[model samples]
Target chain A: MKNILFFTGRELTVEEMQEPIPDLHHFAVQPGVSDEPKCQRCGNETNFSSHPCARCGKECLYCRNCIKMGKISSCTTLYRWTGPEPDVPKAAGILHWSGTLSPGQKTASDNVLQAIQQQKEHTVWAVAGAGKTEVLFAGIATALSEGRRVCIAAPRSDVVRELAPRLQNVFPNTPPAALYGGSPDRHTYSPLVISTTHQLFRYTAAFDVMIVDEVDAFPYTFDHSLQYAVQKARKTESALIYLTATPEPSWREDIQSGKRDATLIPARYHRQPLPVPSMKWCGNWKKSIVPPAVLEWVKTKEKALLFYPHIETMEKALATLKAIDSRIESVHAADPLRKEKVAAMRRGEVPVLLTTTILERGVTFPGVDVAVVGAEDRVFTESALVQIAGRAGRSADCPTGEILFFHYGKTTAMVQSIEQINEMNKLGRQKGLLDT
Target chain B: MNRCLLCENGTEVDSWRAFFGAKAPPLCEVCTASFNRLSGPCCHVCSRSLEEDGECTDCQSWRKSIFHSNVSLFHYNEAMQDVIAQFKYRGDYVLASIFAEKIRTEAKKAACDLICPVPLAPSRLAERRFNQSEALIVCAGLTAAPLLGRHESEKQSKKSRAERMNAVQTFYPTGEATGKSVLVIDDIYTTGATMRLVADALADAGAASVKSITIARSGS
Candidate 1:
């Protein structure tokens, strides 16, 4: 039944269910947070609190980490379905994308398919604009054909929203259920699921193949609970595909030491090298007025995205930039007009968009130059700088664009981002993936 | 690092001051600003924000009521609604601390002999895992006197204002209330129906006076 399918892989509290089912699996909501306490839903070991419970009339320990998903206390009962797995119709001729994959994408796609078939963990260390999503199409199609559930989880809702339609276009026969906070398709059951990583807290062993896009993106790379959610959302023996433009330093070492399996695509599908950021010393842009170097860069009249460390600084600078051009807009994560501003930039209505690091990735603005006003700020991590540079030179017609890093003093992230870009370019040329 | 209980942002406080004081403030400045404190020209009886200083319509209608007055701290705006939902409905007990200081101040001003939390029905208690009123009292460093027991009734949140007014009294005295000034503590004073019912029951039990203090007061 549709109702049973909804509960197939979900862990819901008794109260959330409204009424107790006749026969199903039930477990202690909180698994004793006293001795090495951990949240069963999110696997958060810390951030636990206790209060006197009226249900059991005892002190109940609850997890504060995943409380946003609804509180899970020691006194509550969590229900799951231990019955037979729901019947998922095998989807054939699922992938309908007509676009062809480049040689680099083809190799990575083959590796992804192999990983899915063998149920092994693999990483796709592809550069930004390298068509990483296309690499997953074959594997997802193969998995769905076998009647196995697949999940493509991203760290941010923005990425999930951007990915859902593209995946739906390719897999026409199997429309993936997209899940996020306040999403309309909450209870839809489908073979393929596209969801934000936060939504995975309610799922348990739901996917046969789990693909985590933007694995190095914020709150995913920083928050350990998101990683735990990915692990928990997958079956006991399932394949994992970690897609990221820049992996963490430790993961790079693991790839080199042969401890992890990986496939690297160093070039974009356009066969052009990534734009390397050039650092220019601009003294004290925060305290003083917008530096002359930044002014000169803006005067070039190329549609650009100027990244700032914080929203306050970006908004303060917006007035000066708007004096130069009224069409210039500023946006941040909390800005209600974020989507509209980004769209305005995409439509080339805005000359330059000043923003915080929220716009560093998962957005494509073709033929736009990129610059970081405060490249020395700690918020601009190495991967962030690289992703910011990747925003340029995306469209094949205009295969090259400038990336400027204007700063008081270049930080290690700036130097490393440039080095990584050059290294990827070098590798791309050597592998014949780039037009030298 | 001390994080805010509401927003989870790092709460910056002087270390020495916190070390010397009872405890650091539980919320950051931004989150604290979201709570709209009741101030200037509120109703004398129910503390509802009014254009001029006088009793509100609801309090005016309760001219024959037994309770003297109700003092509430914050206006039941959207932020207070979310706070109450998290604390009472979602069972996030730690959120009760957000209102601790304000509740403590209000309760002290009331100066009642007995601090009584409006009891929840046994079924509601079993579902929510804690009596939110009791949690508010205890978290505010005030001892709660379980002076009332609630009979099984439909949830007040599910009922309309007219229905709540016409509904039968649900609370009965569980402890001695003779000649005692009772200050009833509840999370939100919505319709004044539940509070008046509790006050009537306490009055029937021969309490000297009944005054109430709530964290938030909804404009009925």
Candidate 2:
């Protein structure tokens, strides 16, 4: 019998067995929602799945933690071919990208290549729009040349969607397979794979080179199960690279404590300073949006993202903000037309979008001014505020824009968000990497 | 560690403890407010809560029915749906304990010769490992005796309200009843079809009387 692997590594009963032929081996899937039924996204395994799931109709002991990437339940099953190694994903490929990395990107890119070659774990602490993906092209190319399988994963599907085409463009000879929840190429195997970290649940010691983008993003920042997924999905000798524009303070502590190796790229690819957020008291925004201040800011930009603390409140704010511009629209995770709404914004048809924290990261619009309605809400944490600010000045053409926080009261998150950007910019200047 | 079965929001102490006495449900405050209990005037036959002080149309058929009366603890709402879904479908048997306590408090009304759980098919028994209603009876510190049996049939969950209300009789007594009074217990009273069938089977076995108890009843 061909070797097969079960999702959650469960002990297959006789009834579930299609045929018990020679060499048939069953795996005991771990018993955990976070630990066993690993979230295919941020990999957090909190004990919150105590609610009965509607899907499996079983008390599904797996991770019931609500996530954008789909919930993992005990009934959710993933099968893998463990009969024999499917003859490694070897393919013919040559570097075909025409774009060259900047001097800073070149240094980080070289460091990544050297670390991956030695099978050592490393972190690429690049700022937003620091050409972080480009820094991986060289390292990936070198790995492919040596016939090692490579996988690039991120907590958000958008990052995987964004990275796949770029990686495929750079390595035209070796097309990268993109895997997400509903991805059509889920079963297909390729030498180069780009997938959301959640899809890593089906793999076990599979890749030789693993690159995780947006390591500090939602579902990924605090979730240890995703880290567990990363570890289980790669070979023991594989090189794992954590890429994040905003590294958590704990990571800084690790680097300072000499517990981890890191390459910190403080400046953007264009060498411009990160745009710092300026807080403006709008006085209890739970009551209203100060139209004059917001109108003045929106009047300068072609597009803007106005953030909210909750869905119910965002709907109310969306109604009020519609007076500012008829072209304004709203989107959230539950909105069926969310894709179309975001596409309209990208085409510059919509001038303003009222959204919740769902769009805090893994989304970028060039030179788009951004603002937070209630910066004091606990939902807007320091890291989240930092990612929201990172959305500004993303495009090379528009390297600077306004990042404002209209708050009922100035919050520590607001202050720390500004401090984090300023600190990075200061480090950039100290290293002589910034234009100003 | 006492995660409220309803809204997963509050700590077990300050949140759940804030509502003490008879109002202290095994749920958080927000969820406690959503709990629809079967209080006030109800149909004497089916125990369904009513706006008036008489029997409901479904229970008005009690004159032609085999079951003498039925009692339920809660009106099936969204909270009950999740609770029952966890118990019946997800097979989170532990959830049965919550209902067990409530049923035990109410079981004083069901003094009978023996308490019988609505039987489950052997296939479902193998898959789920335990019948949900049986777990409720066992956990209530009551001795659950097997008084009925049924062949493997279509599960009631897959049926619509109309289908369940008119479901053909499937249950039969496992042994002779011989004028003995019995109480039938189930997880949820959806359209009263399962209870009707079980009660009818007990009546056919020459039982003197049949009564039914359920944790929650379909309010819709």
How much DockQ does model 1 earn? 0.66
True contacts kept of each: 0.69, 0.00
Candidate lDDT scores, in order, read 0.86, 0.75
Expressed as tens digits, the lDDT of each residue in B1-220 for candidate 1 is 8898887588867878778774667888988899998899988888888899998888887747668888888888888898888888778899888888888998889899999989888888887888889999999999999888989989888988899877799999878889989999988887788888998889877788999988898855
Please, what are the lDDT tens digits per residue for candidate 1 over residues A12-104? 766556343545443323342334677777888878778988777788899888887888776655666677777667664377988999999
TM-score, per-candidate, Cα-based: 0.90, 0.77
B1-220 per-residue lDDT for model 2 (tens digits): 5566544565356545556633344567777677688888888878777886678887764336568778888888877887787667655655666776778876767788888888887777756646877888877889888878888889888898788778888888787777888888887776777777888888887788888888887854
- Candidate 1: list runs displaced more than 4 Å: A16-36, A292-302, A322-326, B1-3, B7-22, B28-41, B48-62, B75-81, B149-176, B190-194, B217-220
State each candidate's clash count: 0, 15
lDDT of 2 by residue, A323-380 (tens): 7677888899879898899899899999988889988887787768899888889999
Whole-structure CA lDDT of model 1: 0.86
